[model samples]
Target: MNKTTWAMVTFSVGLGLSACGEEAGGPTVEQVAKAYEMYMNVNLATELGQRIEVRGWEDFKPGCKSSGPERVKCITGGKVELMGFQGGEQTVPKPVSVPAEFDLEFEKRENTWVPVRAQKK
Candidate 1:
């Protein structure tokens, strides 16, 4: 193979390896976003008198930065459907498209990162 092609392959492999290694230090952005969305739905349900389930949570690309050895800050801006009751209704829920973003902090507990606090942005 040409040297240029070999160098490109080497760089890609190294980048992938480094990303895998970083997983040992903290939870991923996806985890933080899921937890944050769950909490938001709970509050929304109580206040709106309806149930809410966030769909497509895995697709949320929350901006995560290391706050400490066991802490991470996550900011979110993703589209998800809230599937559940719309109000004080008991029937099946109709899915609603929602564009939401949240700022949250997570602390590592055991083998998972749990949301500790949420801040308004």
Candidate 2:
């Protein structure tokens, strides 16, 4: 087989094996909170065209439950600065500290839980 085909087969086999060996149980509260923060930052990056970090997880809560065999649902919230640049050259989106709250759902793929939904609350 060519090098490209060999690499593809290897990757496919690895992915299949990983799925078969996926972790069980819901993620920890800390992990759920961090995942929420990451998703929020990703959203802000698109709208603000810059990174605005989510912070203050000291009072964080994951109120998570098993929504499915490999899924979890959480009611969580946090804060982030809504400050971005001033135009298409980073146009002003206003700079202000804001509450970031959401009802999020995650699915376990392999060993990590990935956010599958983020409904604003």
Q: Which candidate leads in TM-score?
A: 1
Query: How do the residues 25-99 of candidate 2 rate in per-residue lDDT, one tens digit apiece?
Result: 555555554555556555545455554433344455456677888777877655434444433343344546566
Among all windows of 10 consecutive residues in model 2, the one with the lowest summed lDDT is: 4-13
Runs of candidate 1 with Cα error greater than 4 angstroms are 1-25, 28-30, 86-94
Question: Residue 30 in candidate 2 has what lDDT?
Answer: 50
Deviation from truth (RMSD, Å), model 1: 14.9
lDDT of 1 by residue, 1-121 (tens): 2212221111111222121113354445445545655666554455666656665554555666777777777666666555675565534545566666567666666545566766656
TM-score of each: 0.62, 0.56
Residue clash pairs of candidate 1: none
Model 1 — TM-score against the truth? Answer: 0.62
| Residue 11 C-alpha lDDT in model 1 | 14
